[model samples]
Target chain A: MTRFRRPSAPSRLPLPPLAAQAAGFALTRLLRRIARRKPAILSRLGPHGGARFLIDLRDSPLLLLMEPGARRITAHPRRAVPRHDAAIRGRLPAFLAMLHGVEDGDALFFSGELEIAGDTSAVLALRNALDDAELDLTEELAAIPGRPFDGWLRRASGFAARQSGLALSRQEAMR
Target chain B: MMELVCPAGTPAALRAAVDAGAHAVYCGFADETNARNFPGLNFSRPELAEGIAYAAARGVRVLVAINTFPRAGDQAIWHRAVADAHAAGAHAVILADLGLIAHAAEAHPGLRLHLSVQAAAANPDAINLYAEAFGIRRVVLPRVLTVDEIAATNREIEVETEVFVFGGLCVMAEGRCSLSSWATGLSPNMNGVCSPASHVAYAEVGGHNEARLGGLLIHRTPKGAPVPYPTLCKGCFTAPATPSGPAQTGHLFEDPVSLDATELIPKLQKAGVTALKIEGRQRSRAYVAQVVRAFRAAVEAADAGAPMPAGLLAKLTEGQAATTGAYAKTWR
Candidate 1:
């Protein structure tokens, strides 16, 4: 049906503690922001809200750990990725594409663009939760209370997506 | 003309399928009453009613699937689902269990009934029996029938017939397989799951990606290679040595592949199929829309006596490989 034939060009993140911490802080804020706005996202996780997930960008130097129950996320060096109940590994764009609904998760996995291991049910629950949410991070960010930079951020997202070919927000009905 | 039936796992998917030109859309409730009972999938009672209304507004029929076998001690759950489906204005109810079918027939005689594929009714006799016994108006033919056999079966049956044209291919007889329960203690016919994701796990072992179901190794692939879900029937296995043959290690039952019979639309139409059904109720709205749109175009072309279109869904299938399966009897 829909074919994402473009290969995800490798983009490695800086492994320095400051960079990793900043990335983790940003993602953690994003998750909390969405959770506050759309409580159904976490509610959909059911019992898996507490499961630890390791998000490993294979080409990147840092990994992310997320706990929906605590509404928290942390970052670590790739070599020091912490213990987790489950892990999802993929290119950065692939992860974003799935998150933004620009690409189908099963299609991504079936095409070998992504890899998952351990406690598949948790991963499936998380996927379904995200699917139900129909999340668009750009929209969430633009909704921030004191953020007069919505227009600027939206413009920047468009520019970055065009330059790097990453899906930064939801793509509606590509088929 | 062959009706294009599509699957919808969620309300959004149901709307997408209808908008994409499905003649009918099939779905199930959120509980174990139907198959595809994955977490966060299927519809709630309110959602089903809304979805049915949405499709009905667009001239699309909604068929509720309550195909799982009823538990020995708890048949009310299944019975209530049929009643609710009829009450919610479903166009029909696809059922498998004989008792449940009978119950629906007697309790709601006006409700249209279609024999589910889970019933494994691939012959004219079985079809006619269901038709006579429970007033089945249609039979979703099992995937085991060849195109020729289908034509032959249609010659004797007096009801409409539906056939799966795409999606995950099951090697065992539908509804009759016990392989998943042996591995996971849950099955499709009962629990509406196979290799239930809860029992599956994957690990990185010595530069290979190993997938397991119920703690049993299903497959190991080199890193970056596509790894299939560890479905029991499609798992790689090793047969023990016997007097007549040495031990064998490989995909002994069936290869991991999805069915794509878009090219055979004309043949199936000629075989007297009333509908061309696309599988994957667990897939997303995007998938449902894409496949429904593609199949709708193909069905339209076939009905007009035009050449069937090429397979544009190769990238969307499992293992990126498509097969004709029993339709062509290529392997047999």
Candidate 2:
């Protein structure tokens, strides 16, 4: 294991530059891992379906994840509606009535609150896959120390420091 | 001189605004088609027609705001609102939402269309895009630009520009915030209400009053210390501690400050704003009359190259603080 000199200040001290970089790198890696698993979730939803959604972000980022392939859709901050297409753009009450069947996760990826740009079908499919997956990155990230990146880097660098014989600094130790 | 477009939630408010020297008065029908869907607010069909006649008698114009997005599969309601406004002799109808604007353009060719701030078309390109596509005569700017940005926008867009000069302020881009819907499942764009009263609940716990919206505690304040309505973006929250220090407590999004642009009337006129809008369609007629009268005096002073009148509506404020809000870069 790496070790390093400890910094003096505990509360008010800033993280060393190396620690920050390590944290950022770990975050990117984790994000990539999630992205890689996205296809696995999509495959379960079949291949060509679409769901419209609205995500309300009161407690968390309101998402409208949809999986058109698997004919699955879900939402959060539940209102009413299963799907709203361009054809039903003006009947809000009816759309809301349909929203009642939706779950919180379904709204997160496919809701009207999110404006979907190009590849609408693909986005809808991606949303479904995301909703069905047992991923809880938001919760996991929340529990981590510092901003998500800082937490990852601090832990990674701390491990590296222990193997190196350098004394772990106070700043690194607290992180 | 620039036209003064004032809000009139009620028939009495409309008459009072016209009497107080508003060049034009904007109002909405008493229904879900309008943003201020509060009970006992807005005008009836006959009242709208009468208000229009009254404004016409005084050489003032009346614009109807049918600004809410039509619900999906139910376009008739919004279509009727546009048709009714035209039938009632409104000078124009303010609108947002692409689908609704397209429908109005096709259905009511003769009626003028002014883009509402809900469009959030801040840049010149977006403004021009709407003007070119829908023949929008005027665009009510979102409260996100500085005077310099407004001036630049005026130079680029062919349509007239209207800016809010006083009253309620929104920190985020209007129609783009999901904070309300996230908590209460109602949105300003879709439901025409933000931090709606139906979803808000207040409780006194210990010596503090806690403001809860959709069952989430948003603000806790000392009793009788003037608890601001818990608008999600303007509430105080705790940010977790960072490596740099412990957690910080304060408004993470924005402060509870209303926009009072009276002092910037001349600068806005110089920036080529065609009209000045005063928000508050849910206000009392007395509030409407007082604000309109003060703004009229200020506009007249601006036209004459004189200083604005001082401290006009000190008593009208909710918490005794006002901001120019993003009109100056200092807001950022």
Candidate 3:
């Protein structure tokens, strides 16, 4: 069991330098676990006119390449400028929150937080796959062996609730 | 008594809305024909037929939404939806696109027609045109008008006006906003999904958590701080650096809040509004039941000239923030 001090200051960089590589490996393992539980999700990917999804984690070394129907989708960190059908660019937490159901995808997209490009049909197909499967990402992550990442999830949730400014805003509105 | 038209994403939600005192519950087929097109939501032909029967037996009404624009090449799917809605004995077929309305009016003349809010027909001229051309009975007014504007439009148009009194608020002009498509590559007009669920990904980076839609960063929060669902309009973004200024990021269009017009029930009555619509068909049956029961009491009290209840649904709203939307003549 490994323990670390609480992060007193948030990193200004997009992702922590050391955590990116480990996170990518962890994410790949986690995703494989999820796909195993729900193979039907991956099935929504292959037939979308040969679309490959590029997930770009800015400020991090993890450039996840997802090839629809091709074996071993996340060809982890290969070479320069991956040839792909579509790419989703963001930090690590954004991806985690979505897969974990801590946030809503449509809501994020509407907010201009998530950007999608390339063939939309491919993105739509991916969306359909996950929707059909309905896996609880947070729960699955918590159940992952060799790590207790549940603490981070719980802390993240508590952070969202506080930042929401529920009482302050509503009270101001009433006034 | 003023009629309350509630939303029903599923048959169970339909029953819950009706039982909680909705005069009419609106639903749609499981396709791109309606706005609330999500997975595992909506009814099939047999299910819709059964829902209609269930509502009719209890002195309630069922409205079918064939509201989304019918694709140019494959209009038959939507046509089949309209025909099936009429066959299922729906009280009215809610429509948005002019061509589909024309098709419904020409083919199913006897079926009642209600103009959907997706049309964004804000003024009297547009409402009158829809009423005259398609014989539309009611128009679900968009959330872009003040109550006074609604009353003014009501005086000019012949059709009954239904206004959304509660639920989520859309800041963009309905049916016109393409921000979702710009970001997600999926158009709500064509796919019936805005910021679709499949493309969303969230993760924690550094000591903060970030949310993304499609792939663009919309929101970031200090780790363990509340981050809202990135509904492009409501998501926080850094505005492009302006002249003599640096980039400022915030919820530029609107906040991650819901619309709750519970207080304006009496004022809307004076505006000659025909029906009060609650916008959340995609919500659960329990949510439908709770909102309907509360609104039912509020409407009933208003009819009797009693004091309106205070903050009856303060807790149900997302982020516990509610606004009157355009009814109060304010920005979202």
Candidate 4:
């Protein structure tokens, strides 16, 4: 199993200007939702100290979240960082080492492929929490038409086309 | 004629496969270069050289598998494996990682490159990307595509395609799954092991036996029933339901079934697959010999336009039943 690396920012493509702008706005909204849920989700992470982290996904924009004492959580969207939190970052494999070891409150940041923006320790706790949560939202996400903006980005970026080897058939893409 | 590639985890297995009529025998180094990084399996450098010599003497080819992705900053070890395999007279080196493939193609232009199944090159576009970017000569297609899809893919791609005909089946996309890593720190792409035996624990709970992998309760069965290994994807689990219904419990992803594409041999050959690979490098030498001989006979029958063989190794499956898997359209 290859460890997940935060995908680097895509090289600017020759996409239609409006489509690119729409993608940017859509990504921002998605990050905000993730940011808003950080505190509530972190609270369920059991007891752990806070850490600062960054999340860099290929389909989504960058995310920087901080949890202090595993209670208060702050999120910064689309911000550049000086350095990644190696302590938390170095343990990416360890975070994935076991499913149950992940907690919601631990702060984690993505860099390189993923960049971390702030403190390292708290981020690790948050990562643990997310892993422990047995949230099965696949069907729910499937129910809502276009609920996951990331899926839309994948479609827009031609990744989904690559998956099916055909243009999004109108029916499948709509569902 | 289409090639008959076979699996050989050990030097003894390699010789046995050759004797049993394998056109090419694929094996990996004793470390993480291969997916079947099981204890007491695979070949050392000298062992591999000797195996290649033995195969060459018998007019059989030896292909070395160094398919695992090279870790960041740890390219040297994987690169060295590629170099050593080439030096040992391997017919080709099977690879998966993008960087590693690039390294091998540039550094050893003379060596033939076959894409490992772990690359998950399921579509014509992905296969073309690999062929265009790395000059890969052959691709081991993922076990996710239907026969029709395989035929379509063969039409669109420039490289020869290989498909699995027997052995363990992966429900998820090959090389893309993180379930094993999520449960056990070791992953197939990184450590070359999935649901490693070391991390497995079985316990008696509530008068039933529960099989746990990396501390997650993956399987629970009545005391007398056969308990399956807690491979993350194939295990039973409960998923929370929506507001409209109660939670559901079962094999949400897939049941524990091994693939047997023997029945589809003619269709697969017509679909233009260049070779059929049997997936079991960790299997016993006897098992390897048995499967290779059976498959070789099957392929020859298909080539001769004869009827399919009967009673072909019924006792070798994990369970009494076998599935055509994603080779047939209904599997999707």
Best prediction by DockQ: 1
User: Which clashing pairs does model 1 show?
Assistant: none
lDDT of 4 by residue, A1-175 (tens): 1234443444233344455356545545543444455433444332433333444333434333333343322323344442333222223332332222221111111111122223222333344234323222322233335656746654553564345333232211232
lDDT of 3 by residue, B265-292 (tens): 8999999998999987755554577789
All candidates' chain B TM-scores are 0.97, 0.95, 0.96, 0.94
Residue B308 displacement (Å), model 2: 1.9
Listed for every candidate in order, the interface RMSD values in angstroms are: 1.7, 21.6, 8.8, 20.9
DockQ of each: 0.59, 0.01, 0.04, 0.01
- Model 2 spans with C-alpha error above 4 angstroms: A1-175
Candidate 3 overall Cα lDDT vs. reference? 0.73
Every prediction: chain A TM-score = 0.87, 0.29, 0.58, 0.37
lDDT of 3 at B159: 92
Interface RMSD of 4: 20.9
**What DockQ score does model 4 reach against the true complex?**
0.01
> How well does model 2 score by local distance difference test?
0.67
Provide candidate 4's TM-score on chain A.
Answer: 0.37
Residues A30-136 of candidate 2 have per-residue lDDT tens digits of 44555465444434323333333333222222223333333333442223333443111212221222222111211211122222223333433333333334344
Place model 4 in a CAPRI quality band: incorrect
